[model samples]
Target: MSFVRTLRQATAADHEMVDAHYGGFALDRQADYRSFLTAHARALPAVERALAEASDLPPWRSRTALLAADLHALDAPIPAPLPFQPGAAAERWGALYVIEGSRLGGQLLARSVPAGLPSAYLAAHHLPGEWRRLLTTLDTHAAGQGQAWQDAALAGARACFALYARAAAIA
Candidate 1:
């Protein structure tokens, strides 16, 4: 099986749990929207920082500023970023998978947000074909790397999901 598919299958439960936490927020309501943005603010910055520091993955624009802009528009304070430091290249790839995958959902979620609310973060969809490029990169990295790399990737993805879950719960 392709590494991306394998990773997805392994982390399905974690992804679903994180979705449940995020799905509970009613984005139409301003307060709920603030909470939603707040929850993301708590996790994304830290993850992006860790990725920037640890990996030489393909260049992708950071969504941290976009998230901050959304929070600023809501007059909601950007919460302290949750600490996240992926320990290896495989682990960083795993975290990146979670982060990039969220953007697909974010596109749909952005539509439900009230018309006047800021959604730069949610609306920050990948440039054309970006997702495919990322998947290719992931698969290339995992090719012949064997089970140890896969395990680290799974651990990284699970840890990332937990971070988002924790941030959501706190928000």
Candidate 2:
């Protein structure tokens, strides 16, 4: 199935969706996020495929930061300035999705933990602590306003990579 190309085109309605998706501590979009993920998770491979059409992770990373730009466009006060063109904020979200997908897929880090046992057992037990760390980082950023959403997104993605790396080492 094809992922929504409108995510790339980023229409006005898309901006509303991005804002709604990240509703966090202040805005409380967490429930929406959960619902969205549950509804969209199965379709993410199409997004990944579309992202792969891009040259590298940075483009996706930039996409994840699209919210900041949108907020700015909408005159929403962010703690910092946005690093991308207006209407392109969802790029950051897309990037975050790509980063997590890579980690989950074990392309960069094994999706298992080794307790001096067989690899199969390791794969069965995902490290909650690692997942927590990644989620916390994401939630932390998702909760607040920022100027450089791209930078923040990159930082969050890096944290996820580190978490996965640690898990892979243990596996």
Candidate 3:
């Protein structure tokens, strides 16, 4: 099976759990949205940093800055001390998959945000076809490796989901 397919299958439950945690467009209050962005801001930078160590992968563009700006715009207190640690490059790619893919959902969530709420983090700097491009890169890179590589990637993705779950709770 393709790396993307395999990874998706392997991480299906983790993906569902994270998606459930977001709870769609139900965040009617600014406080709720603040928590969402805070959780992402807490975890994304660390994943991006880990991905940065991999020369084969494209440079990671962090949305934490935009998330912070959105929090500030909404007068939400920035969550303190995002203490996430990253794994090796292959593992980090799995984590990056989750982080970068969030933008796809962010676009959907942005549309559901009630007017008067800040959504800069959700709507930040989107480019057409970017997700597909990144997926292709990841798929191509992973396809060349052995099962160990794919397993590491799967583990990384699962770990990221759990991390996000905890952050969401605290946020």
Candidate 4:
């Protein structure tokens, strides 16, 4: 399939996976609602960079704004450390919604200087190979065949699922 088409496919899949991650924890724990987002304090930049680097947008100003709005939906307090119980479906889905929206906006307005991804994705966090694989796919799509975003987004979205699954070690 065309890479652009692949990116959109990845976006749909991205939405679904985010939903699933929230769903999994939502069933038993209320704490999980916020736990997912706690990391976003750092990850949001990653997301923004993913979009910004791709679209050449400025770094996220008020990165916490998106996260805070999502947190408001939950009844539970912000999560603490490990041993957190993922929250109810309502909670998990809310966070996922935030991610989708942020990603969507980033994808929409994004205009990167270069066709390829910035160094952070592979370096800083050094996402697992699975994640890197998708980034690489985006890289290929970005650098390849006229340079595209739609294709990169979908591919990146699909890759995000694998990362989430890997983190959870879900079969």
All candidates' TM-scores?
0.97, 0.22, 0.89, 0.36
- Per residue, candidate 4 scores C-alpha lDDT tens digits across 1-171 of 644344445467565765565445431233543454443333443443344333332122334455545455543333322221222222222222234444443333223212332212112221235333544544453454443344333344444444444433321
Which ten residues in a row are the worst by lDDT in model 4? Answer: 118-127
Who is ahead in lDDT, 2 or 4?
Answer: 4
RMSD of each: 1.0, 18.9, 2.0, 14.9
Q: For candidate 4, give the lDDT of residue 111.
A: 35
Most TM-score-accurate candidate: 1
Cα deviation of 95 in candidate 3 (Å)? 1.0
Runs of candidate 2 with Cα error greater than 4 angstroms are 1-95, 98-100, 103-147
Residues 61-108, candidate 3: write the lDDT tens digits: 778778878888877777664555555567888888888878777887
Q: State the lDDT of candidate 1 residue by residue for 10-35, as single tens digits.
A: 99999999999998999999999999
**TM-score-based ranking, best first?**
1, 3, 4, 2
Residue 121 CA displacement from its true place in model 4, Å: 23
- Give the TM-score (vs. native) of candidate 2: 0.22
Q: Give the better candidate number (1 or 3) by lDDT.
A: 1
**CA displacement after TM-score superposition, residue 148 of candidate 4 (Å):** 6.4
Shift in Å, residue 24, candidate 4: 2.5
